[model samples]
Target: MKGSALTFVLGAQEKTCYYIFADKPNSNVGYYFAVQSGGSFDIDYTIKAPDGSIIVNEAKQRQGDWVFIAEKVGEYEFCFANGMSTFAEKVVDFEIKLDDDFKAELPKAPDQPIAVEGMQHSVDRIEAKLNDLIKSLQYYKTRNNRNQSTVKSTERRIFQFSLFDVLLMAGMAGLQIAVVQLFFKDSRKQLV
Candidate 1:
């Protein structure tokens, strides 16, 4: 299987979609996705067939994985919607895989002098290990991205709060000075 992965931002109250074309019917396809950042780490996802029929639909989900066979030869629409967020944009990571015939090109062990049933076992084990490593790397990358976004958001809020605090203090100081000046003038008038 060969696939491509991408990370994208979905604007608030917007829909982001991609189309996949299956050249033939009954082709195997797999998909996985996750919300890396934004409100509650959640978003709505949908998969629609060429005929405009909904194949899969999920709401407020953080992650999902699925595999299916294409029923028709055409374009399929996959989408992520940030409608639930009024101001926060979402960062989403997704991957799509289509079954290919690359495995058929692997060198067979039949030409060896001593052919054993378990000869290909080592190769399979190594492949499995590599896949696991890739998954772990991807997971950490997503976590790092989410943390950065949180830091930026917190910094902005703190700046705004500090600005408000400074303005309030200045206003209070001006009011105090005005009251003292008024008290001194009243005392002078009484003395005169």
Candidate 2:
């Protein structure tokens, strides 16, 4: 069976992020996360077991990946925390993958000894290659998201700087005109 995957946007002022999922004891679970946008592009994250034990704690990280084995049979919680941020919100992308090791039962083919073994091997190799390709694509997607965040931040800074420059220029112009008028007034009084 295929695992479940989801992408969601976390809003501002969230102190904790939680995902509840059930896992059998000894099952392998994998999690990956990236902060696509927000203040500083970083946050704290934690993973808790059903009994409230901390499985993983990461401080001020922009992205991370983890793999762990479930030690008990129950619900587990995966969380991201943005408690340090007062004004800026965050956008998070994450995936939780389960490797249940379930093998599918296929119909038995006619006994063509050589062909059967070769075909199965070929299929397995192709599947492995496809998984690798999928992982690389995910990496690229995360990189692209980070680049977008950087661009937005730079744009905001540039706009603010431009506004400040305009205001300063206008103030300088006003001061120059006032100084010139003062000089003319003094000169006219002296000539009179």
Candidate 3:
């Protein structure tokens, strides 16, 4: 049923109830969602089951949205990475819309099989969600970087102006001193 790793619902109004129908539904199903490399320029990332569950546990040098259907529901996990750097400053956004509310409807032994169009829809949903997420990431990252850069530049300019003011004050004081000294010396010579 679930053909893709993820799905995104844009302004999914209040509650139409969208859920990922897993391909291999079982009693032990653990789901996961995480960003690949966080907010880094070029960071390889690997994710493991956050709670040590094997739903998705491994160290990898890759990046992207990954979805895993495990053996259970409650043990789902999530993680992110920034392998390009060891700064641990990466911030990846992820979500888990877990549900145990709907069980697959089984046909009676005498009934014909239901042609539930789930897989196709799942793929479409995942793709749309992934694309949306990527776009949102780009938007937010650009905004954040620009804001920070602007703040930094403003701070630098303020510091430079401050230094200039100090230098100008020093120059004016020195000139005033020289002018006063010259006036005194000339006055004394004239008086003599």
lDDT of 1 by residue, 38-61 (tens): 887889989999999999999998
TM-score for candidate 3: 0.38
Angstrom error of the Cα, residue 101, model 1: value is 7.6
**Top candidate (lDDT):** 1
> CA lDDT of each candidate?
0.83, 0.78, 0.45
Ranking by TM-score: 2, 1, 3
Residue 135 lDDT in model 2? 74
Instruction: Kindly list the per-residue Cα lDDT of model 3 for residues 1-192, writing each as its tens digit.
Output: 222244322121111122333333353333333333323333232323334534433443222344444443333334333444544343333344433335454344444333344544566688779968965775565457546756777899999999999999999999999999999999999988
Candidate number with greatest TM-score:
2
Q: Which candidate would rank higher by lDDT, 1 or 2?
A: 1
**Candidate 3 worst ten-residue window by lDDT:** 9-18
Q: State every prediction's TM-score relative to the real structure.
A: 0.75, 0.83, 0.38
Q: Write the per-residue lDDT of candidate 2 for residues 94-185, one digit (tens) a residue.
A: 87877766655344567776677787777888888997797777778878988898898899999999999999999999999999999999
Cα error of candidate 1 at position 187, Å: 1.9
For candidate 2, what is the TM-score?
0.83
